[model samples]
Target: MRFLAHTECFFGKSRYDDLHSALGNTITGTGIALIDTAVVDSAAVRDLLSQVEIHFGNAIPVSAVSVLSEPTYDQLDDLAALVRQSDPSFILAIGGGSLLDLAKGVAVLLENPGLARDYRGMGLVKKELRTMICVPTTAGTGSEATWTASFIDDQTRIKLGINGPNVFPKYALLEPALLVGSPRKVALSAGLDSLVHAVEAVSSPLATPPATALAVKAVALITKHLPVALNSEEEDSWSGVQMGAYLAGLAMLNSPGGIASGVSYPVGTQFHVPHGFAGGIILPYVIDFNTTRGYRGYELLNPEMGSNRTFYQQIEELYGILNVPRNLSEWGATGEPAIRTLRELTLNQRSGSFNYNPIPFDEADLNSLLHLICQAD
Candidate 1:
């Protein structure tokens, strides 16, 4: 494995010093999580301190350094209050998927308290958390790359993201080459996950102009280079991977993903399927089912979108592009009892996908949806 360091600190406080005062944050504070990738040195800490000082007119205290492999919500309770306790003007997040997820959790934690479960599901909270600047290293998860973070709720054994337009990061620092050394599976899965984000967002219920553009660009980039991703080690593959991944990020910048994602979390965690593959497994079925409602227009939003196939055929073509199995059976999910449960969980997940479906589904629609998934050979 190759290791690289990306630091977010202050070299010149003067740059942001005036900006901070304008925000009326003269006594700003900085929140740091200690789970960074590189060796932590005094130089790094000093630079961070200087940046905070430049903004707040004084050095902010670095309190609550928690270390973990990635981001977690189980860290501290009363997140909003904890941030208020420090009363920092800025929160700097530096780490991988887990850390970025935790930063988002903290962003929520600081605003609200008591059972994080209280805030589960879409658009539950509205108030923004502390000002945050996220710097991503692995290029996977693009967690910093986006506003929401997915964290596992150990109590429920399900992973849920901190949802809300407010949670989108104030800004993210992405260096493409940083993704080169990542594990092959994680890189592929993360890249594919972005495609789902782009697709669902474009076909989503609200289908905003900005979101459609993002999803289209994401599809073009991902389709163009997935083969190179699987086969080549060329240095420029970094550019392909970076472009595809960023396009995925841009996909949800306007609209969030659909039901496949909503229901896949439980299915994936329960069945131990990688989230990306599991979600992708059902994407075509959902699209085909949604066809009853005229989802074809969604595919045309992109200048270089798929062509020549019927909508369902185009969806099948999409699966070929993703390089995952054609059905759950291919992934070893074919027991009668297991398939039954799988169908049920997937039906449950369909609710989250409401925005993108061309038509609304009732219990019977879910039955049809499940039947398609179970027999998708």
Candidate 2:
């Protein structure tokens, strides 16, 4: 029954502007704004940033503030350097998972000695981070609500991260309007990432009763609303999906994802595939594999995902509707070399995830899973 989410969140169409009070009251002196360069000019973000400038100007001089945009993957050192140079009092991160993750890395490293590479495992981050306010423009990753942040190791090109209490943001503001302009691929991929989280959270051995409840609801919301939200321009649909993703994130925080993520992280890093797409394509195989082992919670989830079909059936159909890549080969992550890299990384870098899976797996079993996901057609 252990469940924890400390972020104070606000959700609505234009609720991003509500951060004015939080900014004015909490952020004094110089602060840094980490924005997604892709959306810096959008009307919604413009309005949000304008609000920040307006409110924060009254409390502190705005000239000292710094803005960094479009943070990239495998560049944790670069991001941390920027943060060190800025030396801001706080950070306001607005954008997708990458931007928010960069802010988290910076916040943690600013207090702790050494680079992002110094902290890799759970609970290594002991010192309190600078105040961070997360606002997610995309309805994916749920980075705003989670205490973990991931980055690729520049040298080894391995995906690495840290998870602990120190990195959680103090505030999360969700504005569904900001999600309206996401490219179709981005929208579908990100949405499916949340769906994977829901399924994995409930299926994981680490799942508790409270986390399972949240995961079930998240699965229901995603199944019912994601497709509708994709085609319809209604804010309500987007809002439902956004909240669903957030709940799924919370579920995952309590019970980290298992096999699908174990396979996807290495596949994504080695193959240069988007993390969400990698997880999206691999999740159906995981569902099929887990269900065969009498994994719990499908009975509870099937009803919510559409009572007419099994939970796995619903997920497969959702994949078709969303037009996601059906196999790893489509993304060029197949064959012996890709398989070997995936196996090594999964067994080493992502080994922590193995215990959380409902069923036990050895290297041979993992190889079979990779082959299953890498199949053509």
Candidate 3:
């Protein structure tokens, strides 16, 4: 059982203020703050920045950058160049997964030579990165707890991850207050993304007992809280989803993702589907496929549903409640041509999710799955 550890996490309702306090006490140098464009103007962000200003009292300057969209290699490189000019001692990333990923890429690029595309694969970063603190405003992607930073290839339009020990953040701040007013669709997609992470981690061939335990608990928490969190403003419900997402991320560090994760890349990059939605939409299908082939890994996720309903049915029912689409067709990734493109792209990308899937998934299996999901509904 191998486990890679990094990122000390602090969780609570308004613990985001702790980031400012930590920075004030420990660091005397300039820092860079990356804010998600969607939430940069929110009162929460404004208050945090104000607190930082008060704490520093002009002794240490912090530059704030607005980040939007899933970063492409070119975009990452451009951002890196801009951030390099500041030469910050640390980086504070506040936003969703995309913004956090952009911050991670920038942190690595500051210490490492070459373009973002150069470190597209695993363990390519040769140097230690600048200290990074991730504060996620969404409950998905688990970017805060993971060592992989995702980016898109500008030329190929393929989604790839820059993975290595250096990619791990120094700290993760999980403040549920940051998630209070997220859009309904955004919250739903993020919650479902965490759900997919837990499901895929438990279904991975490399899953350790510890990882399985974390993933199982994550599944239970997310399943119980996502609906309530989406429909209401209760901090406890949001907190549950947040903790579940973080645990799912930790689980994924030990146990790689499965077919659903592999398929999400192509679907997300090609169809412009949100990553979480892409994975969540395909998860139920993958679960059914695996169960029919006698794979019982998911049975541990929801034992209470029993043999009568099956774990797949439980997830499918949740999808109904969440309004998740049945297949890729809803995202316009339809037709045999699109499926062929996605299959080739998935193979070419060589996502580890394929290798780590609970069942043996070859080209034939991938092709079949693609067709099954891409069929018009």
**Count of steric clashes across candidates, in order:** 17, 0, 0
Error of 2 at 314 (Å): 1.1
Per-residue alpha-carbon lDDT of candidate 2 for residues 115-172, written as tens digits (9 for 90 to 100): 7777886899989778877878777788999988887666677766767898898888
Model 3 global lDDT (CA atoms, 0 to 1): 0.83
The TM-score of predicted model 3 comes to: 0.92
Greater-lDDT candidate between 2 and 3: 3
Give all TM-scores, in the order shown.
0.69, 0.91, 0.92
On a 0 to 100 scale, what is the lDDT of residue 363 in model 3? 87
Query: What digit string (tens of lDDT, one per residue) describes model 3 on residues 252-307?
Result: 88888888888888888888888888888888878888899999877787673344
Per residue, candidate 1 scores C-alpha lDDT tens digits across 73-100 of 5653444446556655556665556566
Return whichever of 1 and 2 wins on TM-score.
Answer: 2
Off by over 4 Å in 2: 13-24, 58-74
Considering TM-score, which of the candidate structures 2 and 3 is the better prediction for this target?
Answer: 3
lDDT: worst 10-residue window of model 3 = 59-68
**CA-only RMSD, every prediction:** 7.6, 3.1, 2.4
**Winning candidate number (lDDT):** 3
- lDDT of each prediction vs. the true structure? 0.58, 0.78, 0.83
lDDT against true structure, model 2: 0.78
Order by lDDT, highest first: 3, 2, 1
